[model samples]
Structure formats: structure tokens, C-alpha cells
Target: MFRRHKPSSSEHKRDPAIHAPALPHNDMRSFFSLSQLVLSAGHLKPPPVLRHSKTTYFEVEILDAHSKKQICVVDKIPPSSTLLDVKHKFHKVCPQWSPSRIGLRLERNGSYLRDSVNIKALAASSIITLYFTDMGQQVTWTTVFLTEYTGPLLIYLLFYLRLSSIYDAKESARSLRHPVVHLACFCHCLHYARHLLETLFVHKISEGHTPLKNMIKGCTFYWGFTSWLAYYINHPQYTPPSFGNKQVTISALVFLLCEAGNHFINVALVHQNQSGNKGSFPSPSINPFTWLFLFVSCPNYTYEIGSWMSFTVMTQTLPVGVFALLMAIQMAQWARKKHQLYLKKCTTYRWRKRAMIPFIL
Candidate 1:
């Protein structure tokens, strides 16, 4: 499971090795910055073992910045080794530098690369420092969703809540991210917030922060996205040029259906997941039935698109429209990727489904 690597910095000034073994003091806190520790934690993720081993192994050259020298040459590396792993080996030699502190770069099949990609399991190397700064952000992900338009903001909130409720633990982490999430998303978000702290740290829980207490937070977290939308729509003294109750009602119905669909799909996948069946029968953790169709179908993604689309239809605001477009594109990209992974990994996988879209696409 582990390989021994030679530590030789080809570039840096050669300093005397500390052969003296005093206290193995835990100054890793000193050597590793906060971000570095998190990066290391993330880097600890092991590669998914593939069925076949590729030939034509690549030689990754590790450059030592100190001496401006090309130090060690890593040979016969499996295609499975990530650019990050290469840098990790480099760091072993260049102990004076962490990935965050070095000028690492990757040359993949002799080309400079950008973005997160799996290059057909080929021979390539990166300037460990630069690649990881970009790569780490991909692996450690967190972002808040906000709608530019106010009317359909509720729909966005519902969409976010629907996705997050499945991974409820993330909400508690969000409390550390922002008190606003703790204060006013919606009763649902607050419910999850309470669920999180109680699930993890019960003794230090607070009643005021309970999802029930933060009605405003709950509303904003789910629907109160555009502060001005509600004000303009429900103003007591305001009069509308024309009212379209039928259109509004239909949009609301679509939004509700999407919300329900997302909730059920996640529940279905979670229930059917069998990730622990490594011995006799194979099992997946949240195995879904979306792959049965032709393209790589992700029903959750379908619901997500629908939810946002409903928001756009209801609000008809430029910001909501743009956000919906971005979300749809991103969701399609994700669904395609997952479908591809399933196709590549599973012998029984069927490729008839077209992502979130049905056969027409």
C-alpha cells in the first residue's frame, strides 16, 4: 500500500540532516499552514483503483527550486497517480517547501493543463505547487446559492434545501460559514441546523438558533432571495398594471413538483445505496436508477433544472434568468460526467439515457 521514496532536493542549498533524534515534537502545526493541513487532509483521498493497468509509464521530473536543478526522476509511475501525488513525492525531497510555498507546474503529455480533468490515465507531471493551488479548490468545495430575482427566490431556497437536506451535515458546517444561514434561511434549514449540532455536538446547542426560531432565516434561506421582490409584489399601496394569477399559479405548481421530485430522488438513491457490500454482493451508497436509460441520466439534476427554470419563469428577472442558465449548464456537465463514470466503470451500465434530458436531447 505504500512505496518508499528517496528524499533528494536537486535545487535547494544542501543543509546538514538532523540525525539527532530529540523530541518528535508536533510542530507539523508549524511546518504545515492551516490551508496546508486541510490540503494534506484532502490529498489523503486515495485514487479509485481501476480494473486495467496501462503501459507506457511516464517519467515525472521533480525540479528543486533551491539549486535551480532538476533533482529526482520518478519512473514507471502508474497512470492512476494524480499530479498531486507527484508533488507529494517532490515535497518529501524538498521538505523546506510545501505545495503552497513552491512553484510547481504540470506538463501533461507535454502540454500545460488547466482545470480538473482525467487525461485518459497517461504519463504527465505538474509543478506540484501551482497545480495543487488550483486543484485543491476543486476537491474542497463550498459555495452559497443566491438568486438575483426575488419572486422565485423561494424556489431557489427550496432547491438548495432539497439538495442539502440529504447531506444535512453540511448545514451545521454552514453555521460556521455564516450566522445568516443559522438565523434566517427557513424552518427547514434551521431544522437541519439543529439536526446538525444535535447530531454532532448536542451539549452546546442553542434554542434561539433552532430552525423554528429563525422564520426569517428560513424564508430567506429558501425564498426571500430578492429583498425587493417581496416588497414590490406585496406592497399594500401598490397596484399592478395587470395581474396574471394563472401564470403565477402554474409556475408555483412546477416549482413544488420539482421540489418534491428532488426530495424523493435523493431519498430513493440514499435508500438504495449499498456501498458496504464489498464481500459477497456489490453494493452502492445511494445507487440510483437513472442510468437505466440511454444517456447518463441524473433525475436529481433534472429536478434541479426544473426548479430553477420555474424560478425564472415566475420571476422573469434578469438575474434569476442568468443564474438559472448557469445552474442548468453546470448540472448538465455534472450529469454527463457521472454518466460517463458509470459507463466507464460498470459493465452493466446502459448508455441510452441523455443526462437529465430524455430521448429528445
Candidate 2:
């Protein structure tokens, strides 16, 4: 009878406010309120992320080479930018200076930086300093070449036609023109015509430009030489070759051979360059004309000299001989420089190859 008394529903439902242990408002309530505030804020908006950028940028400072004066500062350049890109930016800052006419170097008198060089490679820090030189007025190499070659052709033709102003009209009409005179005209025209054609199609001329002064000087030389040579060759009193048909025939044959060889060598050089072997030492190819490459570093110059020499012998004129000699000296200088460049660039090149000659230059 004194067993357990059954709890009533009202006793089971004791007051939650009195029976439940009170939470510490300083610790639990504060933490709960703080957590609830954080959750509510998070739901409303994401927390701002303080991220650091990893991208690198560059700044370039260009100064005058001689005066050391500041040209301009190009900023915000990417790491992948090249010298060409810097040149473009510099051009924007200074529109008067063209990219081609803008020469940049590390030092005042130092060699210019190539357009292909990377800006990052040249930089010692995020900022790079360059010396700028305003290369004077420039003309395309093609324009220079065309002008140099065309003047001689037209000048030679003018003399050959024997205008009344150039030659005495009565003497020119009475004077019997030698068979060699006509032949010499043919050869001269052929030579210049071939050069014009080669300039247009065959040769791999540089994209670089020449100084306007240099082009003017070159034109003066070529036009002057053509005038001097043509004046004597086509003169009314001009004589035939000394040894008659024999000397003319032999020299003409030599000239023709040399011209053909020069053409073949130039073609081979173009092919080599097109095959991605640019600036490399040229070697002998399947073509017999190109075989001269084995003996001469500049076979084209050799053929050029040979053609002139044969022309001198064909005409047997003092002016032509003098022209040949001067041309030989000039070509020798060019060939020597080209040979030195080949040797410098290609260590494996044959030492026996002369600049222009086969054995002795």
C-alpha cells in the first residue's frame, strides 16, 4: 500500500523557468547572441576577402643617349612584352619618333637592342632604363636598291641612244658603229635588267632601312659610274675590242657563265633562307653553281667580280678596267666582312674558304 504514487500531468509539467538551470548571460548568452549575429550577417552578405594580386607589371624609362635627358616613362607593361612593344609605347608618347628610327641601348655608346629581345630579360628589376638615339631620316632598303639600280639602267640607255646634245650629230651619223658596240649595249642592258629583276624577286633584302644620306651617296656613286662608263663606251669615236671577234667571243662567254652562276648562287641563298637557315653559313648544294660555296664564303661576290672582269676584257676599255678594279676592291671589303660574320656566327665553318677568291684573294 505504501508503494510509489503516480505523478500527475501538472507535476510532470513543472515550471520550465524555475526548474531549468539559468544560462549565464555573461558567457553562454553573450556567445549565443554573438553567434546568432554572425550567422545572420553571413546569410545577408559574404565576408570581404582581402586577396593579394600575384601579377607582375613593368615600367620602362627611356633617356637620350647623348644628352642623357629623360625621354618618357612607359608604365604598366606586361612581363611578356618585347623591345618592339616598348618601342610602340614610346612612339605613342613621342609621335615624332618612329619605331624604326628609335634606337635603344643599355648604355650611351652601347649596341642597340634588337626588336625581338624580351623586355623582361633586359630588366634587372621591375623597372628598366634604356638609352634612346634618334636615328635620322630613313628609307626602305628596297627603295634604295631600286633607285641605285634604276638610275644606271636609264643613264646607260640615254648614252647608248646617242642624243644630239651628247654626241656631235654629223660625226655620230657618219661614224660606222662596230658590231661590238651593239653587243656591248646588249650586255650592259642585260646586266642592269638582271639586277632589277633580282632585286624585285630573287634577293632576300633586309626589312631594315638605310639613312637617307647613305642612299643619296650610293645613288651618286652608281649614277656617276654609269655615266662615266657609258660616255666612253658609246662615244662616236669608240673602237672595237683589241683582238677583234676572238677576244669578244671568249670574254662574252665568260660573262654569260658568271652571270648564270651568280643567279644560281642567289637562288640557292634564298632557298636556304626560306628553309629557316637564315644567318647560317651557306654550304654547297646539288646545283653546280652553288658548288662555289665550298671554296668561297661569298660566291655571289666572286661571280660579280668575274662578270665585271670579263666585261672589261670584252670592251678592252680603260674606264671599264678602272671600274672593275674599284668594284673588286669594294666587293672584297664587303666579302671580307660577310666572311668574318659567317665565321663568328658558325664555329663549324671551313677555314679554307676565302672571302671571294677560291684560293688567293
Q: Which model scores highest in TM-score?
A: 2
Model 2 agreement with the true structure over 171-282: per-residue lDDT tens digits:
9999988878888888888888899999999998988777889999999988998899888888999988879999999999999999999999988888888989766887
lDDT value for model 1: 0.47
Q: Which tens-of-lDDT digit does each residue in 35-120 have in candidate 1? A: 67787676566788888854755566665444446666655545566655555565676665554333344432234342223322
The C-alpha local distance difference test score for the whole of candidate 2 amounts to 0.90
* Residue 25's lDDT in candidate 2: 67
- The deviation in Å at residue 320 for candidate 1 is 1.8
The residue-level lDDT of candidate 2 at 183 comes to 83
Query: Number of the top candidate by lDDT?
Result: 2
TM-score of each: 0.41, 0.82
Candidate 2 segments whose C-alpha is farther than 4 A from its true place: 1-53
